[model samples]
Target: MTKGRSTTWQERIDIVQYCLAHQHDYHKTADHFQVSYQQVYQWVKKFEDGGQDALKDGRGRKKAPEELTEADRQKLEMKKMEY
Candidate 1:
């Protein structure tokens, strides 16, 4: 299984849907999609938890202050305090 394979947002959504349609079989989904089993599992879980929007890639994306969760804001404050 290929690890860290880069897939488009649509591809992730398709994989998640396929996995769900096939009874959440991560191994079969991964094999069919040429992605790692872990990727299939994580994508399906993300889809279930947050719907299709969660399948979007978040790499190199930054959240605005208002968008940050309480724990994230606290961690940012702690980092600033250390400087």
Candidate 2:
């Protein structure tokens, strides 16, 4: 496995597509992309489960109200009331 490196969203999508195209060969994909095998595997899995949108880097981003579950919305409301 190669050392993982930062990849852009488009790169991740490309990697996932490549892996899928090659019959989910994670090792080959990782080697070709110069990323860790685990990264290729995980990206492919996420894409399979949720499509391209799932490949986004979502860290530190707040969810929109509509994107939250009912329970989560209620929790947010309670926290707002506390403040």
Best by lDDT: 2
Angstrom error at residue 15, model 1: 0.3
Candidate 2, position 28, lDDT: 89
Q: Where does model 2 exceed 4 Å of error? A: 65-83
- Candidate 2 shows a clash count of 0
How far does residue 40 in candidate 2 sit from its true spot (Å)?
Answer: 0.5
Model 1 lDDT tens row, 38-81: 88888888999999898888889899999999999999999999
Against the hidden reference, what TM-scores do the models get? 0.71, 0.75
- Per-residue lDDT for 22-82 in model 2, tens only? 9988888888989999888889889989999999999999999889999999999999999
TM-score of 2: 0.75
lDDT of 1 at 13: 90
Number of clashes recorded per candidate: 0, 0
